[model samples]
Target: MVNDMDNIAGTLQQSLIQIITSVLTVIGVFILMLTISWKLTIIALVTIPLSILVVAFVAPTSQRLFGRQQAALGKINDQVEETYAAHTIVRTFNKEEDEEKEFNRRNHQYYQSAWKAQFFSSLMMPMMIFIRNVGYLVVAVVGAIQVIHGQITLGNVQAFLQYTNQFSQPIAQIANLSNTIQQTIASAERIFEVLDEPEMDDKIKETPVLAGKNLPKVEFKDIQFSYTDEPLIQDFNLKAPRDKMVAIVGPTSAGKTTIINLLERFYDPQGGHVYLDGQDIGSMTRDDLRKHIAIVLQDTWLFTGTIFENIKYGNENASDEEVYHAAKMARADAFIRELPDGYQTVPDESASNISQGQRQLLTIARAFLADPEILILDEATSSVDTRTEVLIQEAMNALQQERTSFVVAHRLSTIRKADQIVVVNHGKIIETGNHESLMNQKGFYAALYNSQFAGN
Candidate 1:
């Protein structure tokens, strides 16, 4: 695709025009040649199909080579993205040599594929020229003989030579345009391939009003799911009130995040249902469903913008005072004010101006500004300092006072006071209770908590 971008934009449209103009020129010149001499015109027309045959033979090969070149270029881009994104870890682990070798290998592969594609495309012109000139030589020789015998005029012979050049000129132009056309085809196919893919179901049902005291704010009943063919969550069941914090805890890749993904409708369960405020999540528009929720992820993201702008992202209508208040609640105000530009400083991809913890603070402040009806904290405090984490927790406590909240935490201390702590392992909820009750049960949660505190 990148390869296509480099070549397609500059020539595709122009080459299409060239092809049309050249074909018209060929036809007009052919008619003029016939008025001068039919014999010479026939001679010139004979080599054209040979040129067309050469073009036909090389086209499929050129297309195949271009495909390989694009694939290799995509791989090169992928490697570069991975290596640069993990630059710190790569340097720390001293894997520079291995990374460089991998990049060079991909670069070489791209070079090989590109070389072949260009070579095949490049073959068309010279072959057409050779065939055209051969016809040119034959015409000049035959016309010379005819002229000497007074069978044709010398003026006519000269005109025939010029007409012969004009006739083959369009064919030569076609050879050049062929390269652009092939690449444009390849690029267009790639683009439309993505466009042709199936999209998620996106029908919005008419939201019905509910009047019930027993409504589950969020519920997963008999949920069955998996990224692959196998079932991960065969019969999962969970229910939480409209105003409380429910924490999901588990080992890495033990399907804790998957639960949040399902509730958020990132992926729907193969069986059973996820409900929000007594309505099936699948039946609601994803945009409408997500509007009431705000998620603060472990990996914070801030675009190129001022601290004030970043804080106001979730609630673009928020006032300056509201942004300031949110920042203070998330304990980000102190550091933000200390910066050289204060709230006006921009932090972007470079990531050099602000620390990771500060970035997390900004995201938290943004979420706070939104004042969502439902909140999701995915290891939200993992980047901040212990003191900052406590402050953020306090802010979360205030936010959850009247809204539903789900917390995915690795640190047991972070969720000790959670209304419910569900211990997950092997894709199943092995235990559920508050901290003290789970400790009393001495079940999976107890074992996990004990392991974290072990040898302390």
Candidate 2:
């Protein structure tokens, strides 16, 4: 909220400064016109209201066009970003021509709107000049008649022409000012759209601090969730015992990751309750809940930093020895030692400096350094080669002992040794038992297992 207020205030201040400067400039021009001649001043004043009417008539249309142009440009930028980020995938799928066509369509829309805005804004200056010229003609004719009748001197006629030019100057300036003001307003509206969005509300009203020594059990009771109007989990229930490894296995789109999301309180369940230890999760502060849980995902993201700094992100105050120990346990220490600078090796942006397997190892090391009581491994080994997968599984086995762990995996070998395996299909738990028992039952789990190892 403080950030939002600051942004809004800054924008308003900038807009106001520009408006005031433009107004003062116009006022200065008006004063200069008054010094030329009274008759010419009156004639120039007539064009002031006319210019205002013209601007008022054209400003809205130009602003609307400009706003649309900006929005179209944003879409084009999004398309470009996505294409560049997924260049490899685009090439693999032979989607270059399709993507190019889409980009051209969006670019054309932007060009059209931009051209319209410029066209309207460009008309303002010419219209102002035309009106000023008409006023010039009128002043010259009237002043000549007055000079012949001895109502005004030759110098006065000359002065009237000068005042006409001065008055017309403000009209031209007003046109430019109108365009700028409209654009500023359009930009402000876009900025406010983001600032006005509601942030995640603190669920726990009271500040409840949990000690980092011992962790609590997690429970999901009759939990129902949905991304859209359609339901995902109708009535799901699960309990994760304290300091125990529990693995959840399911087919694709079985709400496996959704469970992890709920456990982390990224989104509240539409119906039912989630409890941590004995307290309802909603009753615990978000920070308190997250402090106890650490997750290592298959797609690891590492910022541009040294390997040491990346691991230190998990626990900023951790000593160097602690970081090394965690890395050694995750089997990442050997790789780090091989690097030119060991732990000091700087990772490229997006961690392109290392291979996929190495990146995953580094992330596992990060999670280990944090030493959370609860850990989540979401397809953590799915992206690596068979050799790396074996190494990560060994590290995972060491980490899971005496810790409440949730493992989601597609490989049957990874979960075959789990203490308990729950098979999920279409967001519902269809079977729950050890691997051997589930195979014996010959149900969904048995079928899935058979399909996975059919050719083996």
Q: How far is candidate 1 from the true structure (C-alpha RMSD, Å)?
A: 3.0
Query: Compared with the true structure, what per-residue lDDT tens digits does model 2 show for residues 295-329?
Result: 99987999778999998899999999999999999
Q: For every model shown, what is its TM-score relative to the native structure?
A: 0.89, 0.84
Clashing pairs in 2: none
Best by lDDT: 1
Local distance difference test, per candidate? 0.85, 0.83
- Candidate 1 residue lDDT tens string, 146-190: 999999999999988988888888888888678777777776667
lDDT of 2: 0.83
Clashes of 1: 0
For model 1, which pairs clash? Answer: none
Worst 10 residues of 2 by lDDT: 206-215
lDDT of 1: 0.85
